[model samples]
Target: MGDTAVGPTDLGPGRRQPLDPLDCGGLELDGALDLLAAGELTVTGRMTDASNATLYCEIAAGESSGRCVYKPIRGERALWDFPDGTLAARELAAYEVSAALGLGIVPPTIMRDGPFGPGMVQLWIDTDVTVDLVALTRSDDPQLRRIALFDAVINNADRKGGHLLPAPSGRVHGIDHGVTFHAEGKLRTLLWTWRGRRLSAEETALLRGLAEQLTGDLGRRLEPLLTVTELTALDARLDDLLDTGRFPLPSGDWPPIPWPPF
Candidate 1:
């Protein structure tokens, strides 16, 4: 299940509403990142439906307090295909890529020490409850198109509809990025509306910039999070995408979409 940023509309008559983004001390990008990285983290609750131990947390530094999600390394369940305890790093790496791409689709995320140990901590995004996620997933929304492009570059293995958080502010935020940056072609997602379509100039330019960055700072930062082989595969995927200048058609090698997609 997606780690939804809970709000009043999502709760029943008596259930406590989780902090709204404003209630969590509303900070801009840099402030939020600093708070997530250096603040005192306190566990507030857990999302039991998540595959791993996903903790809801409150982080405060000085007077800035905000709600965040913490996924501890030790809490990670062993996956046969992925290296043990590496999901947190992958999540952080995904955020780095998103930031480098200038796509704010990902929330401010960092790998930091939490109460349970080092893990991925990210700012919580309050969703617009009125937006129909299922309908949105199938729509040809431009934002989803950008996200689909991002997934292709990062090799995101999971991109279910439920993972999309349509924020009240009109921006979309995607979560649950642990299963990404693999060495193989594992780009499973719901945002395939542009499959085999020609890439726009903007999208192609973004890919070019990303390819350049992967050879510089972004590559250095991702080194600790992904294997050398995975990084090589990432470059190859970018090269292929740029070469084709089109969204890829499903390869038919693996399940193209995730089960229980929403």
Candidate 2:
């Protein structure tokens, strides 16, 4: 991660989540990001639920002890298709794209060199564990639907139920976006409840706005993280969603659902 990236700088606490970035002791999102970027990372635990290398770490920036997940680039296992030491970059890119789409779904994340090597550090979200995600995925909840559409736009290959964390304020936040924005049709998700359903006009407008941003600012932001082919494919995905105007069917290349669904 040579890019020296900052995260969620201007974001104020607009969402109703339990812990908003800007709500912590009146600190700005930029302050939290600076902590994640330059603070001393103390690895506390291992997040074994994820398929890749993930660690639960506490970042100490002065008096603040911020909890975050640290995914080091050196810990990333090699993939036959994707390049090496790139998953952490992709995770930061996902946060940027989500911010560009005007969604506060992805938690604050930044790219920095940690104890393990160059990696990503993202704020730990406190979730409502009592909510039945299986039930949520089976319903017509607009929250899940929006996330589903967002997954399609990014060509996310993994949307496991564990990744869909519901906040205390009823908003569902998506995390672990390492395997996303692929050039090929590699979408494999468990969110198929609204299959073939037409999107609301409001949602359509959001998509249109996202498409516009892709051609300009979002494209520039993702250039360092993703390849040119991936960007072109992302553009094609926006066009495809606009043309179809409905929930997409799963690509037959792989199974629609991820293993160990929850």
Candidate 3:
């Protein structure tokens, strides 16, 4: 089976259960006072406007320590137009999938049932750590190039330079994956600038492995997080990119890079 066909179970652990948003209060969410910075008090003070009614909170914790970030689901808002709350769910799912694939991703600190509804709590990342594409494309780092290629293969629509945060240890972590793997097509930010470039033996091998597993039993296993339609679309997108035998380029009018690293 192609990597796209491979089910979640095929990768490793079965699908992770959705986190209960309510369980986070005072514990993983509101708790952990010592881990926070001096100015930080509680989640109530940090709430910021996210898309729609959904709110995003920054825990005001220092960079080195794990900081709590909360995402609350709101209703009937176009900016937050996720009627099904699938976007939040999808973000969680992507983190889980990337973890299973051995990619370095920021894992959720906690998931709990909220007063509004199901919500998520995750580690706050440094807004300054993100590298702009203009800077990245100008660099001589082969590792960065490889990382960019990996982002392409994964259909990371929002792989803006700002999204790639370099930790104190120098490892890069991608964030804000709420809009990934839509049933329609790959639509979002553009990062594929190396299309048609020759793939190294290692790259070829990885793609081949991923393709074989993506659409088979593995796809079915991801059903809990992704609909069959979404999974099928994901597999098709990967297949198209692999067949092109080229690096991806900016797709549409969307800016090739993301702005405001924060």
**lDDT of each prediction vs. the true structure?**
0.82, 0.77, 0.50
Runs in model 1 with CA error above 4 Å?
1-25
- Give the alpha carbon lDDT tens digit for every residue of 102-136 in model 1: 77878878787778877889898887899999999
Point to the candidate with the largest lDDT.
1
Which whole-number lDDT from 0 to 100 does residue 231 have in model 2?
Answer: 86
**Candidate 2 runs further than 4 Å off:** 1-28
Across 135-168, the per-residue lDDT of candidate 3 in tens digits comes to 7645645645555665564455566555565554
Clashing pairs in 1: none
lDDT by residue (tens digit), candidate 2, 61-107: 67766778888888898988778878988898888777766677787
lDDT of model 2, residue 1: 26
RMSD per candidate (Å) reads: 8.5, 3.5, 9.4
Give the least accurate 10-residue stretch of model 2, judged by summed lDDT.
10-19
What is the C-alpha local distance difference test score of candidate 3? Answer: 0.50
Candidate 1 RMSD to the real structure: 8.5
